[model samples]
Target: MKNFLSALAVSAVLVSCSKKEATPVPEKADTAKIVDSINAARTKINDSIRSKNHFKDFSGPHTFTHNSIKNPGSVHFEKIKGEADHYNIKGDIKSGKSYVHIDGFMAVVSDKHMNFTGNISESVAGSENGKLYVRRGTKTFMSKDGGKTYRLQDMVNGSGFVEYIDIHF
Candidate 1:
């Protein structure tokens, strides 16, 4: 009887030790879904770049369409007499007692690509106090698909202000 009881106890311990819950296996990620999500994000960013904002917000890293930039302000461009692709460009932004002056030389590489060399200076004669701001740099703007969408190149440290502005000619 004693031996039988000892055998039964050992069997109970073995049964308890063998009973274990199985771990769940994780499902594999769907590659197609991930790709689609990434593509959607890219499309959203590209669309925003193609959109236009007010001239005061013309900060760089954005693309501008010819039609979108129309009549934004007093913008003018004159071709250099002897130069094939050289042009003198100027723009003015006025709001009540404040104004900004943008002057530059544009070198057009093609209908979709161009380079700008110039300065954007502004004088604000507001109620508080007057202030002056000036910056000079060269920036290249290009479009991958002809003239539909254009973007600026080398945006790192491109402007002394918040961002570099795009001037469409």
Candidate 2:
């Protein structure tokens, strides 16, 4: 009986020793999913910031109305160092297969007024097809409704015509 009990104990020990615990397998990283989540988070943060500071963040796409014709355009506004409510502006407008580019500075004089001084560069259709004429001039714009709308008193290439180019924000 003692021999039988000792053999049984030995068999139990051997079986226990042969059994192994399974190790967990690591998962492969999904790089595309990670990147998409990161981009979504960044966009959310940017939208929050834009909502809080819409006036300062008006540096994106805008309507560039010139000669009663509205054009699609984009503007970049950078805050000037050491200046209050001043910005350096640069933008381009797509006008009927031609592009009009402007580089300028803007000053927020008051809550209801703003001023802009810039140089305009535009390509005009010449007398013949495929011929382009470049027009360069200075422009001064004023906004009385807190940048909601701007009136261009000075135009590109000429003045006595009193051309009004509205820049709608």
Highest lDDT: which candidate?
2
- Once fitted onto the true fold, the runs of candidate 1 whose alpha carbons sit more than 4 angstroms away are 1-71, 123-131, 143-145, 148-164
Instruction: Report the C-alpha lDDT of model 1 over 1-169, residue by residue, as the tens digit.
Output: 9999999999999998896898899998999999999999998787665443211222222222222122234556666654455668777766555555667886776677777789766555542243665657987877676554445564333223233334443
Please give the CA lDDT of all the candidate structures: 0.58, 0.62
lDDT of 2: 0.62
- Candidates in order, TM-scores: namely 0.41, 0.48
Model 1 scores a C-alpha lDDT of: 0.58
Best prediction by TM-score: 2
lDDT, candidate 1, residue 144? 70
Off by over 4 Å in 2: 1-61, 68-70, 126-139, 144-146, 155-162
What's the residue-level lDDT of 125 in candidate 2? 37
Candidate 1 lDDT trough over 10 residues, lowest sum: 60-69
Clashing pairs in 1: 60-164
